[model samples]
Target: MGLVAINLLGGVLASLAFAFVELRPSLPFLFLTTLLVGLILGGWAATSSPLAKLYGGALTTFLILFGTGLSPLPASTPESFSTRIGFVLFALAYTLCMTALLWRAGRAAENSRMA
Candidate 1:
């Protein structure tokens, strides 16, 4: 619950920042809000929901893209092959980082339990 609220706040702030910066005109920073919200919710749900917990990373990313697609952006932004590739690369990196951190934390907890 707390995480959800924090996520919401962060999403709103990022959205505002994008709007203030006028990112890409048609596709603004509101797109990031969806990604951030999805990541947070997916992560939280994955902790207790067996389905989400099993495929949290993929599900979270899909949700993000879906949310972005539903946004009121133009029919087509200034997207190109390179930009799309960059987005995928960044998403992969972000997911890997999150997974690594979670793995380390789990290991630390297990060690403490054994101790």
Candidate 2:
């Protein structure tokens, strides 16, 4: 519960920072931010109970996907084919990293509980 609260607070801070910063056309910064956010949330979810982890993981994944999909391009400007492909690849890589972090954290939490 404490972990979740901290994660949520961090997320709020990140969102405010992003909102104030001028990130237009800054693909690299956006990508890095998303990666960081996903990893933090994933790690937090891993520390939760099994059922909470499942929901947290799913919600985190969805938010990551949705945010990345919408952040880079304006609605008025239709994304080019290559740009779409790039977003897909970036999302895939982000997902994999988040999964790995969650897995490691979960294993550590479980082992500690057993001990």
Highest lDDT: give the candidate number.
2
Q: What residue runs in model 1 are displaced by over 4 Å at the alpha carbon? A: 1-79
Q: Which sections of candidate 2 miss by over 4 Å?
A: 1-21, 48-115
Best by TM-score: 2
Candidate 1 per-residue lDDT, tens place, 38-78, comes to 67656766676654543454444444444453445655423
lDDT per prediction?
0.50, 0.54
Over 32-82, each residue of candidate 2 has an lDDT whose tens digit, in order, gives 665666676677677756555654644454464435445646542224322
- RMSD per prediction, one decimal? 12.2, 13.3
Give per-candidate clash totals.
0, 0
Error of 2 at 87 (Å): 24
